[model samples]
Target: MRRSVAVRLSALLATGALAAATGMALSTSTASAATGGVTGYATQNGGTTGGAGGQTVRATTGTAIHQALCGRASSSTPIIIQVEGTINHGNTAKVSGSSCNTAAGVIELKQISNVTIVGVGNGAVFDQLGIHIRESRNIIIQNVTVRNVKKSGSPTSNGGDAIGMESGVRNVWVDHATLEASGGESEGYDGLFDMKDNTQYVTLSYSILRNSGRGGLIGSSESDTSNGYVTFHHNLYQNIDSRTPLLRGGVSHIYNNHYKNLNESGINSRAGARAKVDNNYFEDSKDVLGTFYTDAAGYWQVSGNVFDNVTWSSRSGDNNPAGPNPTSNTSVSVPYAYTLDAANCVPSVVSQTAGANKGLKVSDGSCTPQSPDPTDPGPTDPGPTDPDPTDPPTGTNLSLGAGADGSSKASGTSYGNVIDGSTSTYWSPSGSTGSVSVKWGSATKVSKINIRQASGSGTVNSYRVVNQDTGAVLASGSGTGVISFSATSLKKITFEITGASGTPRIAEFETYAS
Candidate 1:
């Protein structure tokens, strides 16, 4: 019965950390329009004074003038608001019928310090949340473009999440934002950036998390042992081929990102959190990478990553292994350069990072410690970038058992993995007691069974799912909660219970049919 480790709902609702007292409460700019510099500042209730038509500030209405023009003043005070038409919750036209979108304000700041939220001209776009910060300090969320629309009859139904920062917020910074296609109910549970818990010194650079069902910068939180120091660099979690379902939280520091056509599992660090990956790049993805078991005290140091036709599944009995150690240390270096479309050849250089290019430094040495001059951009390379089709990367697939009708389509050897008929899939029970059969070959007609009980860190509360020809008893839950089953055609589905008996380990197995 484990399932309690997901804190940082923005610092359990902020109390201290920020306003340590500084100086200069600057606020300039009267009014000027030419397509470049626009500014204005004023935060009455929270008391902030900043002015300047250049640094940036333009909020046209409400949220007490965007908290009197980006409040908090010991430094940082650049605002740019021009949100027109529709506003606040209930979706707000998902970014005002496009013009680049904009509508919704209230970017709070406690401990009051550094603030810079930009998005002028064709810059700001938010049908919902483009930015939302708390307990702020040294903040800077630039080039915004949030699009949390909603209204999807299925297609894996996703909603909510463009940008969200929770309690204990510290040294935050997000650049080049462009979060897209969230789910229904106004895209609430989805994520582009839903960094939770006592977020500390965060930085989601060069952003672009497209059409998310989940997966794209999720620090997660329900509240436990909070201490997030995130830094998901050079972002670009590409097209996301299909299988729209996401869950993985805790620990931070995933480096040099770039994944294309990624289906599921790119970078998940659950169980106890403590990640430190390097030089990333996974293409055509199926399962790029992960470190589960709720990641307790989990340690990682992967290097120079680049797997073109990426496909790898870890977690056998547990203690999932990747390296002896090489994510960082001794000058820092993580390397990668690809060529595996099916071995197209002509792209090699791999290093995990440690002393002068320690492990996996390939380049023809077959990989022994050779990667050093593929152009040299290690020690955290945020240079030489490309991949922005105007922020294009979207795919949502969800399909479960019993011949999922409604224009059914399920293949991959009929669900050994990778299923998506648009999403509404649910299944649990990996404690392993033994039972696995759910085959509705030729038309059996099934009606609904959705369960959810795998919440936070090596999660599990209680488990059970049975319908072997009417043995019925189709529901029983705990912890990460969700159970349902009305009508049943029972194609073939079985899961009997294994570890929750003692708790902790339940590596894989999830079910869903509606």
Candidate 2:
């Protein structure tokens, strides 16, 4: 949204940019793009003040974010668009009014309510657009970046969801977003964030859901159990090949999330859904939490989670998978007030505050990451660019301090990132075969080992050097040099990954004693 608060606010309101104050407060007087209000549970049921004092517009195409919601004045007047650049589907169309009910090329927040679609100056990329939200309620979608949307083959597809909320939806607060989808559902792309009918109190903070093959769902099948009270904090689910969300029934509050890889099955809380998983940091992946295919059953109340090498499959019939171990059958109460932030520092505080334009940074529950509020308006596009790879790694690394589990890392990668010798920080695997271990709580004496790779990732054609307390394989690879193996003493030492050319980033897993 770049200008137009009904005929361009008379020269930006005499040059003061713009400022409004009504129910909450919406001021874009430039302090770097303000939206500093309304916290989680969207603040809770009857509290998701959007437009704030109303009228503070600016939209860069996508039909000006539905023309700042059809020049609001009814249909719950309250506006604050502000977006910028790239909103795909060629300038987007359909902009009726009676206060809006947009169509034609998505980004349509159908049947609106108090609105606010952030992403100021130079950040807001909905390339391959998608942002539905039918029968809206108090809404606020901040920052931005909805990638590769396509619920079906393209032609500027619609419903290929990158953010979809169903009818009767209520209180929705999607902050710092970056919902993505590139391939899955047979390459037609689908679900990066979805909800079915009667969607209820929602909140998805500091987000970043990657790759994709349905990383969303909360009712949409199995008798569509009226979507639950959703809330996922400090998010980041990478390479997802499962519904990091699939709660069928109701209730969800997955805290401090940072699940990496998760190539199949994760937090699928089935039918009678219920989840309150606290302090999460699950890395690698497979069966990260229970109730898969569906036999109707879902309940969780686990706590302080951090399952680093997770992998649990073998429940047969309907395929349950709460992983090698995941307890709590049910008991969740959360009525507001939140603070948890230490599931092993949730992957470095969700890679410095999850998706969309980092300046929306948040997470001061002490694991750090809280900047942006210096009056607002930060982030003029400072994204991408990781992979400084000059390929560094030279001598006796001994896997640094040791202990760095793995089986699937990919969300912003970090199984301590291969000993931290920093090849600009690397360690990916959540796809082309997986494994990356370097443990040591005792016994550590290898006979040379160095795998330094990571200068553009993927290309470890074949590997295996385990001996993790005895499964034994000591050496057997075809890439990433120096694998001598003939002097042993181990507390744990693996590299597994049996073949790749695409999902391999390990910068250094050096363990030497020769």
Candidate 3:
């Protein structure tokens, strides 16, 4: 969504911030209830059942949350803690008990098992705070926003990660959460999400990680290669400089993710890391899948991934490009069954389904088309050369600025550049808020528009296609690519960018009538 929403949510979770309490009200009475079992890839490899068949508890402040979780009399029993409002550690004092010991700065889930921490209602946010999952098993963290947890500052926890797991952690599933950082190490910010110290069987799904120096990492150090078997799917990694994430060593299944504007690196699979990279959309990124930094090396089994305008480092020691020409030494076998959406459809599918507050829209791992096949044609005699009068004419490209002219409200490199066929040339909009429109002398029937971006940095996150003459929105959604809608006859069509993470560059605005 919009950056303003994220900013407002962060502000609402800040210290001394307004307590616009949302979600389930705090309830003292505990209810014994059994929730559903864990789903998705989490069900594989012994399965993950977080708080299944357990009591439901409610907590408001950070201290209350710690009490509800760590103060439990029986640690083996499953529990679902519904968190409401902002749980900023700054608002709560240090909580100490026989079962738990937590500092004032963060909420620690230490030596806990079979627990699910989920935000409810308008959703819960943790501002300037970190959630540390240590020595835990069968855990789930969902529907929360964690932002600006600094690493170098005082009161920092979990190495400044929005969510971090380590030391015998297993079967931890993080879903539908937004994790962000203001800046990189220079800004005292660390990874949005990180796992280390023998952590295994973890899955991060339907999450948004943006504007950070490091997205996440599988292992902590080069020699620390015991952590692995992590799955990252249906996530959005945007506007980050690098490490989208940095996998030191592990067997990671990375698929169906939208990686945009990765300035430094995307997926750094190194130190014998084996990643099954499939059906991911990488735009404007550099060295998306490769072994970087150390020459100890990594392996990637890459397939069906769309690398649009992605630049690669030279093929050298540890600087190997993934796929087309891979330097990986080994291949990984994925144990679980999962369907993959085509890489071309990743931008559209991920923009509609990824991140928190999305109502948990996940694919069912069935990409097979439901339509029936047409019957085979019988042997037939050759027909006449003349075309049938009843048949419609095959559509053609309506030349821009000839029968149609292009214009924009905001100045760009050149409005005409968008219509130019050369992908090397592009029209860079001065600001995020702008519209490029094409008007024809007469009404033309159009069905589809293909938006070609210069690189990942120039990709649009959200936009709308409007029929300018009738002021009708033909289609509206997020991400750049081919946008298809009902065939409409219009004299003027405009593509308006409503929200974007970066300054978008349109290489070609190709219109098709079919």
Tens-digit lDDT string for candidate 3 (1-514): 1110000000011111212231222222222111112344565667775664455555567776776565556665676676757877566557666666566778788887877787654457888889998988888787688989988976576678999888998888888789998889888899998999999888888789999999989888999899988889889999898787788777888998999989877888888888888889999878787777778777788777888988877777656666445444577787777778888888877776677655445554444211111111001111111111132234565535533233443454777777766777767656775788767888888876777678655545446576676544454445566555556777777777765677888777777676
TM-score for each model: 0.23, 0.29, 0.64
On lDDT, the leading prediction is 2
Which structure among the candidates has the greatest TM-score? 3
The C-alpha lDDT values of all candidates are 0.38, 0.73, 0.68
lDDT of 3 at 240: 91
Displacement of the residue 99 alpha carbon in candidate 3, Å: 3.1
- Superposed Cα deviation of residue 495, candidate 1 (Å): 40
Question: Compared to the true structure, candidate 1 yields what TM-score?
Answer: 0.23
Q: Write the per-residue lDDT of candidate 1 for residues 170-269, one digit (tens) a residue.
A: 6555555566664423444456566565656565644566656665444454234464555665456656433121223344556555666666455555
Clashes in predicted model 1? 75
RMSD of each: 23.8, 24.0, 16.5
Model 2 ranges off by over 4 Å = 1-55, 58-67, 71-100, 103-131, 134-140, 143-173, 176-204, 207-244, 247-255, 258-266, 269-288, 295-316, 324-361, 364-366, 373-514
Ranked by TM-score, the better of candidates 1 and 3 is 3
Ranked by lDDT, top first: 2, 3, 1
